[model samples]
Target: MIGAGMGAMAAAARLAVAGRRVTVYERTETHGGALRRHERDGFGFDTGPGLLHLPAVWRDLFVKTGREPLEERVAMAQVEPAVRHVFADGSSVALPGGSRAGTVEALDAALGPGAGERWSELLVRAREVWDATRRPLLEEPLTGAVDRAALGRDPYPARRRGLLRRRPATLTGVARAELRDPRLVALLESHALAHGLDPRRAPASAVVLAYLEHTFGTWYVRGGMRALADAVYERCLERGVEFRFGTAVSRVVVEGGRAVGVELADGTREAADAVVWGAGGPVPAAGDAGEAGGGTGAAAGRLTVLLALRGRRPEGTAHRTVVHTAGPGGTTRTVTVLRPGDPALVPDGEHESAVLSVAVPPHRAGAGRPADRAEAMDWTAGEWAAVDWTAPGAAERCADEALAVADAAGLGLGGRLLWREVRTPADTERETGAPGGAVPAPVLAGADGAFLRAANRTATAGLYRVGGWAHPGGGTAHAGMSGAMAAGLIVEGDDWRGSR
Candidate 1:
């Protein structure tokens, strides 16, 4: 397969279960793609995606893989205040758990009277769309052909008469369809930003996002995320899947419009019935000379960061300082801070660092020489360059950010700093072949990009897709589900395609 990312792992497990002799090629020594882990001394850190929300996807995958049932590895925990929104106006409110009633109540209290009612109406409407598309889009078998299995269930629903009446459109459309609260609208639209997607461009069908998270609830893996990846890898070995870690696949061996095998960088060609592009493309680095060539292991100009922090995070808003450069004038820098989890990365709890990530500013697409002075001022880079967690400067940076949030949210960070770490975008991209160092695969929102993503069916035949890069979207939510659907397509045949 192409990359042994999350989607590729899911697909490989499913393919193996269906009795296919799958051969997966992963460039990294570990599995789990973004969910991979790293360590220094005794401190360990989860590289990407801490919160495991929308977990029905995993449950479903376990059934197909015939492993120790999803419940054995991960259990569902319903946490309240799904997230705490801190506003610069010093106005902050914690949104309750993913429930229609709970959300409305919280909105009403936080926003105003009748605000809850409006939020309820919007979600209720979204719930309907969720029902209509859940089985068809999320669960139903893949057709392996260009067909709308969803539209098949209702060929004559007669609801397509008007554009406004169609189901699963966009976030804005859904808000207009039911909600009047701008705050409520922003709350629902948060998912787009969470994935680094532009909401204005994402489709109304994206409304399904809010519905899915609310109804399904969020979860945390019982252990760290790596355990889950190891489980899947173990399953693959049982099913006889071979892998070549650290050995990059230079290119897909394509001929006569079919991908028969792959050629490793050292000039090794391995043939197979089909090759699944599970591994991500080449590493993204600054000034990558060969990146422009556009092939396997050649992608450049992007990066992701991972930080390992140890010691107890300040309690009750002890963590602070996640910001995004704003407006047309600001650079594209996103900084996120998360408290170490209850399950520490090390035997002693003093090993986890509050994780922070900053994407390396890309060189101007058509610029000459190196980045100019103006570009440097406008673009943002990783915070680690400026702050040292183990040094004296970390205290200043942490306190500065904490105080910023205090002024913004009216919430005080009461504890002293213990430990810290920072990751540059370039570091992540170089290690993992993620383009632009994008995580959770930058949500392919908006009309223009609706078709820009990689499809389950590539230009080649027999090859299939699964994982974060699949349709419906990314995250643990889509990865496991996409794998299941791809498996169904391979096993059931493509006779039912093109109906929609």
Candidate 2:
């Protein structure tokens, strides 16, 4: 394995159990690619993903590798009232999880009558899309022989209203056609935006994202998300997977057009029968040189602010709250407030630790090196770079913005803030080696196939890509799926359909 990201470790555990002497080389000193934690005093914060949706992916990993189930390894709790959506129209809805009827009721209560019905109707459509693409687009690996055309075909059906036959291909289009209300439109588009995708271009199939969250529900590890990664790492060790930390893979050693081993930065060479490339390691800093190259259209970056408050969390608070704003140009600006359900995250019973994440565009050409100089003057470009959270003093500005958004949603911190820490995409790049700290978006079904991800099987024999950057694309669950698909291909051969 090239890197010790979740996908790499998941695959390592499976391959080791298959009687292969699995060896994982991680560039970082610690395990868990983006699933990192930050601690100060007694407070803890999950820097990467706060919640795990569709945890069945990891559950399947544990079941296949050992007798112990996932629950045995990590304690997880379903987040009640899955999310609180605060829209620009001053209307808010607290949507319940796992129950379609419950969600409909909440929407009806908050957004007025018939609102719930319309939202529920949209979810029904989403379910169809999910059923159509789940097997081929997600469970199976994307190989040369696979029918990529089928994956590109949109499964969402067109809408019919009187004489109008509206066939909206994108999520934004669906929002405009079916959900005429701006708040409801924002609610729908927020799902796509949260994934670092532009809803205007994202396929209508993107509706499945909201469906999956509401259906499977959101879950959080007891201690932190890092605990989930630790569980996977422990599972790998139990299967006898060897791991080398603080080691950089200079290159994948190729002989006869096949990867036979890897060359480390220290001039050490380790041979292997097959190579799994998990690009979770850190990339080069600023002008520093590195083996990894930069790529365009990497998923948008996240700006996170960790708040250490002096007050305790009030009772009946939503686990997650989304504050939505619109820019002068009408683009949505979202800031997600995460109040971990676990009490262990705070320093004491009298205090609370909250995390705020805002999706920002990737610094594709780095600061000042514009991809299009004229585009910078455009509203989108300015809106994208409005918060360079990595810049000095920008953290304070973003924290203020988050607190303001929270306050507007009636989540007032008042003077309880003790301290704050900010993390930017640059910080992520340094940690995970993803250029500009870009977060990879999940692949979507679209007409031009512009959103398709790279195939797991590369041109080089014995070499494969696995992780958020590969087939099925980003998100904790998707990464786990990529690992499973890659491992399946190696263990079951190229003709492998998928894991049963």
Candidate 3:
């Protein structure tokens, strides 16, 4: 295995349990690819994902690979009022976790009469999309030739509106036609935006994104999301998986049209029966199998601002809040504020740690030329090549913009902030080695299969792909599922379908 990311580690543990020796070579000195934690003055923050949804993916990993279940390995709880939305009109709504009836009631009470019914009706359609694609997209590994035309057809049931009877094809269209209200439209679009997707281009099937969270509920680990990564790493060790940190694999060693091993950056080669490439970025020795590319455009990264405040966290504060504001060119931008109730994240009850995040163009280190020298460069040509996040005050300026939005949403942290740390896509690139720190969005079915990812089984016989950039797509839960699918394909043969 290459890279000790959450997905890689999950695969390593499962492969080891199946009587296969596993070794992970990670470029970084530490484990956990993006699931990083920053600490200062006893205050810690999760720099990666702040919450977990569809945790059953991780639960199954623990149940299959070891005697201990996921709950026994980590302390976690369902976040009540899973998410709070503060819209541009100063109206707000808090949706309860895992309760459809409660969510409908809360939306009605907060957004006024009949508003909840419109949103609920949309979710009912979302459920159909989820049921149709859940097996092919999440559970099974993409093998052989994929039926792009079939999968590309949007499964989201369209709403019939006037005498013309037109069908909405994009997420934004669905929000406008079905949701109707601007605030409800923002609510629907926020889910896609949070994943670095532009709702304008995203498929109507993207409605499943909201459906998953509402049905599965949101959860937080006690010691930040890093704790979940640590648990997975520990599990790998217990299963006899060897990890070699600070060891970078330059490329996969191909022998007789098959991957036989990997060559390290220092010219050392390690042989293996099969290789799992979990590291993001380009796949090495992919050959012809790598040609199938669909979801590689408009990939954006996240900018997170960790705020340490001097005041106590107000009781009953929602765990997560999203504030929507208008952006340049009539676009809507979302700034999400995460305030987990876990005490381990802060110094004490009197102090609180919060994370404010917004999606932005990924960092671009301007090729070989200095960033300052590339001032006249075109922004649209190279993905993330135009934004110089390392430029002085760039990250701070973005953080300030996000903070202003939070303030308008009544976060009330102006006088209580102690210190803040700004994490940009540049930092994400240095940490994860992904070009431009571009985080991969989850795969959705539509737009002629433009949102699909490369298959886990590559043309190189012994080589396989696993992680956010591969098959099942991105997200903490999807990455875990990616690992399981890869491991199953290796142990049970290519004919193996999926978990029975």
Winning model by TM-score: 3
Q: Per-residue lDDT tens digits of candidate 1, residues 64-180?
A: 677468767555455444666543233445666666777777767787889788766666665665666555555654343343323333211112435654643455555544565
Error of 1 at 220 (Å): 1.1
Q: Estimate each model's TM-score.
A: 0.74, 0.92, 0.94
lDDT of 2 by residue, 31-74 (tens): 98999999998899999999999899999999999967899989
Q: Which lDDT tens digits does candidate 3 get at residues 231-302?
A: 999999999999999999988888888888999999999998999998876666623344334233567878
Which predicted model would earn the best lDDT? Answer: 3
Identify the runs in model 3 with alpha carbons over 4 angstroms from their true place.
Answer: 161-165, 286-296, 367-386
The better candidate by lDDT, 1 or 3, is 3
